[model samples]
Target: MTELPRDRVRELLDAVLDDEASDRDDMARRVYISPFHFSRQFRLGTYESPVALRRRVILERAAWRLRRGDSVTDVALSEGYESVEGFSRAFSRAFGFPPSAAERTSTHWLPAPNGIHFHPPTSLWVDSAEAPRSSMDPTTQMVHHDIDDTRYLLELAGKVAVRDYDRPLLPRHVVLGWDGPEESIAAVLEHLIWSKEVWLASIDGADVPARGGRDIGALAARHETAAPRFISAVQRIAAEDRWGDVLIDALCDPPESFVLGSVISHVLTFSAYRRQVVRQMLRNVGVEADQGDPIMWLRTRHQPSHER
Candidate 1:
C-alpha cells in the first residue's frame, strides 16, 4: 500500500467521495498536478485512486455499522446500493457470504473482492482512515446542490397530475404526502429560503422570523428568492473577515427559529434537508439521483459562492 501524506491523501479522498473524479477526464482534472506525477504519487501515497479509496472507506464504515448491530439493509443502502438484491449480491461477493453471515459473529471479517475485508466490530480495526471528518471536506462543502444533477424532478409529480390531473395542489411525495412530521420538497425549499434569513440574523443585525411561506407559485421560486438573500448576506459577510466565524457559528448553532427543525432533525439545514427531500422524491418516483457525484450540477447557476 502507498503511504499517503495525511493532507494530500485527504484531498484525494474527498475528491473520490464527492465523485469529482468519476471519468478519466474528471479524474485527471481532480488529481491535478501532472497526470503522470499524480498517478505515481497517488499509487505511492494513497495506494488507490480517489474512487478506490472512497469505496474502501464506504465498506469500512459499513463494516463498523454492522458490528454495531445495525441492520444489514440499513448498512447496504447507506453505502449507496439501490436495492436489497443488488446489495446482497455485492455483499456476498465481497464477504464470501451475504451480510446475513455477519449476524452470526460479533467481530467476524469477510474478505471482499474490493481488496478490503469486511471486519465487524470494525471499531477494533478502526484505522484513522475510517473516521468521518468533522466539517465536510472542501469538495463536499457544497455537496447537497451538486448531488442532484437533474433540476426540478417535478416531472413525476406532473405525470401523476396528468394521469388524474385534478389535484389543485400537487401532493408532496404521493405516497407520504405532507401528513406526517416529514415535510414535502416544497416545504423543505420554503424552509431553506427562510433558513438563510435565520442564518443571517445570527450574524448580521437581521432578525430571524418564522419561516416565510407566503404561498409562492412553486418551491423553486422560494429557493430562488433565497439566492439573492444568501448572495447579499455572504457579500456583506465577506467584507468583514471576522464574519466567517459568525457564519460558522450560525451553521453550527441554529437560531431559535430553527429549534423546531433541530428537534425533528428533518428540517435542519436548508441545503441538507432540501437535498434529502429531492432525493426521496426522486426515489418515490424511481429516479436515481447522482448522490455520489456532487460536481455534476456545479456547472449550473445555483452555486452559493463564498465571496472573499
Candidate 2:
C-alpha cells in the first residue's frame, strides 16, 4: 500500500483550512500545484475534494458557534456567507434544520465521507479509523461512500410519508433471490441494512441477527449501529491482510464458506444497486436525491477562481 507523503498532505490541509484560502485555485497556488492536479491529489490523500472539505468544515464550525449561541449573522459572515438567509439555507440543507435549531442537535459534525471535521476552538478532527492511514484504497473509498450514501438516503427518506415510502417504485425488482422483492424504497433500504447484518454475523460466527423494522427511522438507527461495526470489520480485515482468508459460516444451512474479499464485494455490488434504486424512488416521490455516482458522491467540482 502506497501512502501519501504526510508532509505534503499536511501542507495541503493547512492551505485548505486557512481562513484566507477560499477557492480551489488559491489552494492550488498555495501548494504550488495547478488546480486540476491539486484537486486530484487532495482527493487522493483526504478522500474528499478540497472545496467540499472546506465548505463542510466551515459549516461545521458555523454549527458549533450557533450551538454556543453565536448570532447567525455573525457566524455566517465570519464563515464567508454573504447573508444570514443564505447561511441559514445552506445550514438547513446541510444539517437538515435551520441555524436556530442548532442548539437542539447533540453534535455539529455532519456526515463526512472522509472523517475530517471541525474540532473545537479552531482545528480539524480526523477520525483515524475512518480516514485511511495509508493511501486511499479504492475498496475503502467505495465502502465509505456506500455507507455515507445509504445514511444520506435514509435521511431523505425519513421526511417522506409512510405510504409513499412503501409504494412500489420498481416492478418485480430483486437483487438477491432470498432477500425478496426490493421494489419499494422501504424494501431496498431494508435489504441495505440487512446485507450488512447477515454478512457481519457470518463473519463473526454469530447467530443471524434479526431483521430490522422497515420504518426509515428504525432503519436509520440500525444503520448507525451496523455501519461502524461493518467499517471496523473491513478495516481489521485489511490491516491483517485477510481479504483472501476464508470463513466457515455456520449461519448458513449445513454451513457455507466464503472468502472475506468476495463477501464485502458482494455486499458493495448490490448495495450500490439498491442505493440508486432508493434515490430514484425518492425522486419519484417528490423528494430530491443525488445522482448517487461515486465520482459525484466523492468529490465536487468548484468553479475556478485565483483569489490569492
Candidate 3:
C-alpha cells in the first residue's frame, strides 16, 4: 500500500481549505489531479472524503467561534452556510445540540476518526495522541485500582496466620477453566499477580514467565515488577493506536492469537473478580477487607482524608 507522504497530504489538505476552492472540482484543480483521483487520494490519506472533511472542519470552526460568544448568524454566514436555519441543522447534527448552546459545552471538538481537527486562527491541528489524554480515562482508572487493590490485599494477606492464608475456604471457586480453582487466599492472590506476569511476557515476546513464589512477600515482589510494565505496555498500545493489532502466541501448543484490546479486557475482567474473591477470603479469615468497589475507591482516592 502506497501511503501519501506527509508533505503531500498537507498540500492536498491546504488545497481543500483554500478560500477560493469552491467545490470538489475546484479542489482537484488546485491540486492538479482529476476529481476522481483527488477524492480517492484524499480519502486514502485522511480516511474521510474531501467534502465531508471540509464540512466537519467548518463546523468545528463554527463551534469554536460560538463558544467564544460569536453570534450564531455571524458564524453561520462566515462559514458559508446560506442561512441560520441550515447552519443550525448542520451544527445540531454534528454536535448533538443547537449552536446557541455551544457556550455550555465543555469542549468544541467532535469525535473524529482521523484525528484532524480545526486549529484556531485558520490552521489544522493533527492530534497524534490517539488515546485519551487523562490518566482517569476508564481503562486506566480500572488498571490503577486493580494494581492498588491487589497490593493492599497482599499486605492484608501478610498479616493472616500462615494456616489461614493457605486454607481452602472457598470451595469450587473457579475463574478460568485452564487456571483451575482459586479456593484459597494464597491461590487467588498468586493467580492475580501471575496472570499479569504471563500476559506481559506474551506481549514482550519473551519466553513464558516462570511461575514465581506464592508467598506474600514473593507475590508482592512479582506484582511490583510486572505492574508498571503492564501499564507501560497498555499505554504504548493506545499511543500507537494498535488496539486491534494481533499477537500470535507460540507458547500455546497450537499457536493462538489475541487482539491487544481483548487481551487487556481479559486481564482486567478476571483481575476484578479475583480481587473480590481475595476480599471475601480475607473476610472469611476474620480480617477486615475493604469493599473493593471502584466507586468508593475513586471517591476516597480523590477526596481529602478529613472528608473521607
Lowest-sum lDDT 10-residue window in model 2: 299-308
* Residue-level lDDT tens digits of model 2 in 189-224: 999999999999888788888886879768976786
Model 3 agreement with the true structure over 1-308: per-residue lDDT tens digits: 99965556687798888878999999999978888667646654554557777887899999999999999999999899999999999899678799999999977776554568888878888766532244668986787677767866887898899999988988898889999998899999999998999899888898997898998878976776676567667777877889999999887779899999999999999999999888888888889988988887767555532242
TM-score for each candidate, following the candidate numbering? 0.33, 0.58, 0.56
* Clash count for each candidate, listed in order shown: 1, 0, 0
Colliding residue pairs in candidate 1: 4-45
Better of 1 and 3 by TM-score: 3
Q: Which is superior by lDDT, 1 or 3?
A: 3
Where is model 3 more than 4 Å wrong at Cα? 1-135, 305-308
Could you give the candidate ranking by TM-score, starting with the highest? Answer: 2, 3, 1
Comparison by lDDT, 1 against 2, better one: 2
Write out the backbone clash pairs for model 3. none
For this target, which candidate reaches the highest TM-score against the unseen true structure? 2
Model 2 CA deviation exceeding 4 Å by range: 1-131, 300-308
